[model samples]
Target: MTPDLFGRHRAVLPDWLALYYEDPLEITHGEGRHVWDAAGNKYLDFFGGILTTMTAHALPEVAKAVGEQAGRILHSSTLYLNRPMVELAERVACLSGIPDARVFFTTSGTEANDTALLLATAYRRSNTILAMRNSYHGRSFSAVGVTGNRGWSPTSLSPLQTLYVHGGVRTRGPYAHLDDREFTDACVDDLKDLLGHTRAPAALIAEPVQGVGGFTSPPDGLYAAFREVLHERDILWIADEVQTGWGRTGEHFWGWQAHGQNGPPDIVTFAKGIGNGMSVGGVVARAEIMNCLDANSISTFGGTQVTMAAGLANLAYLLEHDLQGNARRVGGLLLERLRAVAARVPHVREVRGRGLMIGVELTRPGSDEAAPEAASAVLEEARAGGLLIGKGGGHDTSALRIAPPMSLTVAEAEEGAAILERALRSV
Candidate 1:
């Protein structure tokens, strides 16, 4: 391919495709917490390729593993078993605190979520699934059906059954506050009312920490209440940890730990960081629920040798380096620094999140409504200053998501925060 060929093609691409190319930097390479654009300019990568490159780009261990695996065997039909697949599943199960958990792998987060939803529906023999408002599961038909966001309205894949519930509104500033007992109770009451009026749901799917919906944390006791309700209804709880798992939250290996919930969920979906940017996603389900599906339902590319090798190497890197612990320490420092910066910048409505999954809410100086345009401006300014950031939240898009690699150092965190502060000031 010619050097200009890709750029020329991108220029003529439809607007629908153009939306995916909004990033100011055209990345050619990356390492640790930095990336180089096509122009050879280096930029600090705070977004981590939408929070998927946990170990950073071109990690030596992961690349080496992928290379070795590719040299030996690249693909294997699902009908046949592979050593890498078995090792990957064993490692994921061991880290997930579910030793006997059966894993169903896929090529992306959406596929993993779709598989989990399928299992939930099949096992319960029910058509309806209750999902939280503002939650983002994935783009597949079933995933989108349960995704509370209305922006995915034009999807054609229809689900057997789907229901919506008001999870909780943003209670405090840019952050959704679920810290109080009353707030927790009110959320539970709302869920109860929704269930009372609708058919019993086959499963309840939720992001342990809302990733796309402004990085909101659930109410203090909300998860426990949710568990109780779902158990009472005999419905499974599907924890969609695509964005919040693999120690991104710092304290725990998963975001569910921050919720203080009891026991593990029946089904958990993971992607993004699991393979450190390699195309790998999977459902870690309770053995019983996993057995509900026949082998014929599996994906051909799921758990491919190459992807499995990458996943294994990524996990080994995370554990050996104690990246989770680093995330916690650096995340706390970043939050503290961000809070200070927010206090000075009137446009910054709030700073919220756990560990490295932080969000900065932007609004007009004295306005209550989200200033999505202002947020976009800030993002642009940050990009010009050599930092890559991302926007999240509902349609408002007023929340700036900061999810650096787990390998990010305190110095890098400070540098990213400094760029953000400068952006806010310039805006």
Candidate 2:
């Protein structure tokens, strides 16, 4: 980015809104998985605008759908009947696996999570919520209140009382040394013990794969074991799939499916990828819980024609092309390559994630201590090497996030992995 543009951005935008690079690039336009900066430097976009571009950059199908819909009507109130909205909702309800599923649209993931919190608290008749450590829900007051990551949680004041739990991260925390089964059992035991000491909370909200927590996740069926306990107490299980949804996780269509023995989560909140860059977020729940609200509420521009049209097209393209399978095949290859690279690099603590959503944690040269500075150096090096990635961790922000578009080809993956390998070693 030019100094003038950077100075203008700092002068206008909030300081809390973070930028990626020391000299942040103003992206001019993009196509496929490549984006060009204002300097006309093209970089392979591995971050996919923080995983919002689930399909590809400037996809023709999505653009055509948005253009057609915009040519007709731009905005429509939620009070009126909307064909595109209803159609997209039907698709979502069918895809959502929740029986008697009802979909409520919101403009962003934060709003979707807010709606989920409202329904859970209203139905369960408790303002208490259970969340996992190092989890990120969103930025709104209600969303941030439940967030367990101190870097993301800005305020201590909140309307709901929240309790933090274990089992989100597998290789950290006190149980990191245990095997998968013993680790899971220990987390479940901890949960059971916690519930014994407190009132029944409204719900347990967790990202099946902790996105911002360096893509760390517990052993499979851990949630199912927890569900066995929560179900006995009538505590709802809510899966926050904002970053892990839309087949990005490769092995599972939904991140929660890795622990599917207990059946689907009672409530699921999603956003960030369904519209392929358009603002689309929603909550899916069973009819009883969704209809438990006493008063009417509507999202003014939640299901606008333009956004829904783009969602429908993107969903169709994603499904028809079987991008999920592509992610599995190509992402498996990429993960192995990055792991091989990590094996040769000492700064890398671990490389973990499934499918397109991967994270490489960095530590100090010869210590286990978190290295935020090393992470920043890798980001700058990766950008200079013509690649764009992201970083996030519990508090120190020492993990490199690599989630490209689902349609990323094997060639692109190889290219990105090479760039990333160079960045990791160079840093």
Candidate 3:
């Protein structure tokens, strides 16, 4: 049954739309942290649909809000007053740390980032933009133009003159051997050198943690040190928090707070968890930057009533239940357990992440070269053992990504870790 459906999918869908596994299983339904395939196999969901399911699967609050809102009105233009949209916006603005922050909703992260580019370029009146190497923002033309990852970026022709900056990854770069302080200083010097050689860029955009680059991150406070240089030149700072926002990291609500010594970014783009399963994405900027556009603009389906209701409910549940605190405690235990497991496996290169967003990098045994085949083997083994995980990285997709829902519990973590241990051993 699954194979027949897979054949149909391949026939209808674009080849570029990637699918996992030798035989992709159909996920029929889910509850809590578990899901069942059409063949009656139950698997522990660790990836959470690329971390889109921030809360538990089939969460009652989100389902109830979505159903209730649909019963009333689903489609309403942004021209009218939207109570749910306003409420959700107010909550996000208050939590954003940007003074007088304003929110504009979009259907996806790509559009949110596209809106940010429009604002920063118009405000600074410059077409030059700076983005971190080994980073991915989105798939749209403007967003792809700034993406520096060669695997994901297909074209170099762009409307904005883009300059790739260094220091997104601390473990595999020219400055990898440096200590934390030295690494930060080296990245800052590199930024200064790059700035001197190029025109004044409108803004410097970066992911607090490079999501598609296998959850890689720079040394702490690296962005803060660079912020000083951009500030002096009047260039804006935009934090792409699509994967790092809403307390997914153990220590902070937003990933930029990891470099809080520099204060808030001029603009922030967020998606992928705000609405749980619903599509909710947006940009938050100070009124000056958000309102810099002289002409009118409205998203046709950006902030419809249904999605706003889902966002409001999900955000409220996340805060009221203190899922951030849950992520910190559970994530710590899971990380320690995975580290112990990796120590026994010679092919496991490194285990790195702040909270639930963990990555286990694989390499050929006794060599530094990436072992993408080992990653694929582990993924297949984990699936056979009733576990679902993900894989991605800059080096031929050699990193195993494990990001469960923020509401993951101690028992579930232990269960997933045990399955992962066996999978690694099999690999």
Candidate 4:
């Protein structure tokens, strides 16, 4: 159906089927960082499908790979090994620096996390799973159980052993004064105490940089501290790189690398950009941890032929063009521009992020209000001005997330920033 027709029908659709809180624009086509709606309005897409399309939309190389693979073979069950699947797995392992790693692919990030949780629990024969507060892993039962966000739960909690820790540096300017280092140390000590009291946790799951948690980067030494603590208790560290992996963070191919070389996680989960928007997710476990899983644990459609082809082509394009370098350069430029804009807007409390993943926090002038309404107003204004961004955090917390594709050019980033400036001004 046409975009207009779909919109009209959507207006009358049941609330359950149409549960979108924010109004969505009808996008007709997208290329690189821009999308055109049915009414011929074009938008600078900073969201990039919530960071899923790292290579950008309608990439010719990825499209070609998908087409070529489709003509030859599409589905090859787990019982059989396919060339594309083997190549994709090898490429992921090589890039992740986890030699001898085994990959079990899934169609989405949620499934990837689900699989990782199960694998960690079963391998260690431990019941406790430790995760960070404000972290978003996925929506599956086990994933939700470990996720600290209670908003995601609709029914009784799952019976998984879980502990939630707090992450994020506290700055005096944005809110009340607090020592970030002290807060981090306290959290670590709490974790150590918890570990001492309960059976050792099966795994410690965390987003290298908290994606859904205000895009907050942990305290400088928090990762290393957590690694040391978890190791002391014999717990595996699971880095959920779903939104931060595949060069999105620039300097490192994976966000975990940002934690320092000594903090390499035991297992890393990836999804968003691996297939360049195709439905593919998986975990790269260290050889020892991976060895614990046998043929009994497998997914029939995990690494399908078509998905693997797309993933392999995406990775090849990323490496061949040095997309990570572009992400760093462009991300730095974007952050500088955003900070400049924030300086002019009193409501903009902070501008923070690493690489292409950014967040602009808004607050009421001289008041404690998080100014979530101001953020919503800015979002709507930006949408009207042909720019697409996203909102996160409970209470709407006044944070707008920006995660454009790696293929986005400097010119495009500038245009998006300009559009955002106008939107902020209107608000």
Query: Residue 62 of model 4: what lDDT?
Result: 94
The Cα local distance difference test for each model comes to 0.83, 0.93, 0.92, 0.81
Residue runs of model 3 more than 4 Å from their true location after superposition: none
- What is the C-alpha lDDT profile of model 4 across 277-362, one tens digit per residue? 88999988976777786667657788999999999888889889988999999999999999999899888888988889898888
Q: Please, what is the TM-score per model? A: 0.94, 0.99, 0.99, 0.92
Q: Which one wins on lDDT?
A: 2
Candidate 2 minimal-lDDT segment of 10 residues:
209-218
Query: Cα RMSDs of all predictions?
Result: 2.5, 0.8, 0.9, 2.7
Model 1 ranges with Cα > 4 A deviation: 1-7, 10-14, 18-24, 172-179
Worst 10 residues of 1 by lDDT: 16-25
For model 3, state the Cα shift of residue 118 in Å. 1.3
Off by over 4 Å in 2: none
lDDT, model 2:
0.93
Per residue, candidate 1 scores C-alpha lDDT tens digits across 158-226 of 765667665434554323454467676767787888888878788988897788888876655577788
